[model samples]
Target chain A: MPFTSIRELLPKKDLVGFAILALIIIVLMPLFLDIFRLNLIGKYLTYAFVAVGLVLCWGYGGILSLGQGVFFGLGGYCMAMFLKLEASSPEATAIQSTPGIPDFMDWNQLTELPWFWEPFHSFTFTLFATIAVPVLFAFIIAYAMFKRRVGGVYFAIITQAIAAILTILIIGQQGYTGGVNGITDLRTLHGWDIRTDSAKYILYFISAFLLFACLFAAQYIRKSKLGRILVAMREREDRVRFSGYDVANFKIFIFCAAAAISAIGGAMFTLQVGFMSPSFVGIVPSIEMVIFAAVGGRLSILGAVYGTFVVNWAKTSFSESFPELWLFAMGALFIGVVMAFPNGLAGLYQSYIQPWLKTFINSMLSKYQQYIPAKFGLGKPAQEAAK
Target chain B: MTTTHNHKHKEMALYIEGLTVSFDGFKAVNDLSLYVEEQEIRVIIGPNGAGKTTVLDLICGRTKATSGSIKFKGKELTRLKEHEIVHAGVGRKFQNPSIYEDLTVFENLEISYPRGRNVWGALIFRRDDEVRKKVHEIAEMIFLGDKLDSPADLLSHGQKQWLEIGMLLIQDPELLMLDEPVAGMSVSERKQTAALLQRITKDRSVLVIEHDMQFVEDIADRVTVLHQGKVLSEGSMERVKSDPKVVEVYLGH
Candidate 1:
């Protein structure tokens, strides 16, 4: 029954878009790219998760959270802590001052591991903590701000402040969080060797699949009545309120949901990339995530994945050759995106490419109308009308 | 489901007593007391800054009252939030048309259907037969039947006003508050709106803040004349127009 109504859930345009994105991610990318490049794409796909979340929370909900990297970092740090603990087991770190403690703790002359790190020793606890920590943090922030009706630029500024504070706290407290270098030397996840190229390939597929799942969830949200209400609230909040909708609760829900989705990506980043760092937890990366959403057309869910890929790919290639010019080029890309195509690549495609594709397909169908008979189950009913 | 709004034996659908809202030093609505009986079309007319719209704002929870008791069907509305007030069967339309411009006329009406208002409820809500029937029913009521699929931004000023009214009608509120429902309307549109208001107010009480005297005379079952944030006269339109204080404050030089 549910599958029968699934067609009504998404429009034909969105269904086509989802199918195309699925093909590229699940089939074409893995087949075409080598292991090394596939790993790089895996890393980029992690950011795509954040971008998809931003599309729901920011684009549709009119919430500009410039600190999504905070949730991402929290999730990553949770997973990284567990992996680091596994790597620095008593048998593994026997030469260290504290055999069972993490190397960073031992290096900083710590005699014992912290109490909070105790639960992280359990993989199950760490797995749940990865999503739970970020979700709880996001819930607290969203509830307080939205309940008080502090929104728009104020919300963005507060979120950015949180990102900055988390980064500073992480870097300043070296022993607990691996300080500036972050939790490195991550070797295994429950005795499975993750540093191998085969593991990287497997992890890439996992990451891509998870990213696509998040995209589907976001697409569902975008096509739902909740999505329309979000757009209505974004445009005229007072009107929505008078329409008997609890506007703040909706805002809080979307914000928290976005946080959870982004957290999953963060966990995947740690698993695939083998480390978590404060470098990805600060203002710069947080703003860059928003750019990924914006460059894809903030309203387009699948466009976010493509946007992240395009931007990150350009960043990687350009930085390798002209490292100094990469920042300038990135700045130009943002400016060009805003000034030229305010709706991003998706908007450009919708305006120019989609109509042409429709016309081209229609023309071809009509041109072949004479060749295919009505009995062949093709062509417009005009051919049948003639018969 | 509606809020626990009990009509009881109370004659008034809406009852406001000693309602006062002071912004800084000046009181926008000063000790204003008004009542609209069930199914009554109560029109409020006043000079500029007479707290006409402020009364609606307070009753609808848009503006907090400095001191007052606003009761709707015997339920206290002072502490309720805007949406809570709406669920209690009070719907408000602003002086400016407030329909979602990006949405179609049908979409606008469907949103105000008083169901699936929660975050999760809206996500799973289908445009089923019931919702479609209600949306079309409202579209026809507002004379927007032919333009149900057209985006609301394409509507004229009068049509937008009707669209907003239609949006409220979809909610099926027991107490409908319309602020300047005919302000930007043409003569024919104003007449149409008057007829529309009369038709809609058959079962529900309507509180209209109208400026046009002719429009007021056409639709008002009773009139409350306000001056300097206080009621100057209260009677039928003919009686209020005849009141010397009302004429001095509202119509005289």
Candidate 2:
């Protein structure tokens, strides 16, 4: 029933868009690229999760959160903790001062695991915590800022500050958190070696599957009445409030949902990249995630996914050749997108490419219409097609 | 004072007393007391800066009252949030049209249909037959039935005003407060709006703030003249227009 409802909610054009994106990511990319490049693409797709969330939260809901990395980091760290625990089996860490505890803790002279780390020993708990912890943290931040009506730039700055703070805290608490190096040397998930090439391939599919799930969830929210309300609130908040909606609650929900989605991406990142670091949890990465959404067309969910690919692909290629100039290039790209094409790649496609493509297809179909039998009715006549 | 005694026998839809709102030591609405009876269309007329719009703002919870109580359907409203006030059966239309410009006229009215207002509810809310019917009904009422699918930004100035009113009407609030409903409307639009107001006010009380005396005379059941956030005069249009103090303070200009 929900699937049917979602089908009804998504228009035909959007379904086509989704299908094309799925084909490219799931089939073409894996088949064409080697395992190394496929792994890289998988890592990039993880960022698409954050971009998709931004499409709903910022584009639809008019919230500009600049600290999505914090949620992503939290999720990654949660999964990393579990993986670290699995790897730190008494036999594996027998040489360490404490055989059962993580190496970072032993290195810091800790005799036992922290209370928080103890639960990570259970895969089920760790799996739940990856999404739940980020959502809980997001809820708290959203409730505090939204309830006080602290929004727009202030909200963005506050979120950025939180990203900075979380990075510092993790770096400072080296003993418990793996510190600036982040939780590294994760080898297995429940006795299965995750470092193998086949493991990377499997993880890539899993990440792609999860990204689709999040995308569908976002699409559902975007088509629901809640989605319209978010747009309404963005245009005129007082009008929406006067219509009897508790505006703050909706904002909080979207923000928390965005956090959960970003966290999932973070978990995938940890799985695919084999490490969760402070570098990914800081303001820089959070802003970079926003750039992914912006360049894709902040308003287009599919655009965000493509945007993530384009920017990250550019980053990898550009930095490999001119590592020193990559930052300047990224800055130029953002400014160019904002100034020339505020709607990003999606808008450009919609305004220019889509219409022309439709016309070209229609003309081609009509040109061949006479060749086909009228009984078969393969294509409509030109006049009807125009209508 | 005499008008208060006269309306005291009737059921009160909205009773606001001692409503005061000060911003940085300037009282926008000062110690204002007003009563609106059931099914009454009360028009508030005053010069610019006479606190007419401020009165609507105070009752609708947009501006919190420093010292006062607003009773709507015998329920205290001063402590309620803006949306809570709306849910409590009090609707307010801004001085300028406040419809969502990006949405269609149908969407604007559908959003104000008074169901699935919470986050989870809105997520699961289906645009069922009843919602569609109500939306169409309200759109027709505001004379935007044909333009239901058109984006609100495409509407003319007068149509936008009507769209905002249609948004408020769908909520079916018992006390509908409109600020300058006819402001920027054409002569024909004003007449249509007056007639529209007369039709919708059949089951609910209306509180309107307007400057056009002609529009006021067409719809006002009782006129309240405000000056410096205080009631300068209160009576029928004829009596208030003739009042010496009202003439000296407001109409004389």
- For every model in order, the TM-score on chain A comes to 0.94, 0.96
lDDT of 2 by residue, B89-197 (tens): 9999999999899898888888899989998889888888889899999889989989999999999999999999999999999999999999999999999999899
Model 2's alpha-carbon lDDT is 0.91
Q: Which candidate's DockQ is highest? A: 2
Cα displacement (angstroms), candidate 1, residue A232, comes to 0.4
TM-score (chain B) for candidate 1 is: 0.95
lDDT of 2 by residue, A1-387 (tens): 222465687776798799999999999999999999999999999999999999999999999999999999999999999999998889989999889888999999999999988888898999899999999999999999999899999999999999999999999999999898999999999889899999999999999999999998998998888999999999999899999999999999999999999999999999999989999999999999999999999999999999999999999999999999988998899999989999999999999998787788779878888787788755754556678
Model 2, chain B only, scores a TM-score of 0.96
- Ten contiguous residues minimizing lDDT sum, candidate 2 chain A: A1-10
Question: What docking grade applies to model 1?
Answer: medium
Off by over 4 Å in 2: A1-7, A368-384, B1-9
The prediction achieving the highest lDDT against the true structure is 2
Question: What does the lDDT read for residue B189 in candidate 1?
Answer: 90
Candidate 2: clashing pairs of residues: none
lDDT of 1 by residue, A1-387 (tens): 112277776776778898898899878989999988889989999999999999999989999999999989999999999999999989999999789888999999889998999999999999899989999999999999999999999999999999999999999999888999999999998899999999998899899888878877887787778888998999999999999999999998899889989999999999999999999999989989998988998988888888999999889988999999987888788888989888898998899999888677667767887787767665753444346
Each candidate structure's TM-score, on Cα atoms with residue i matched to residue i, is 0.95, 0.97
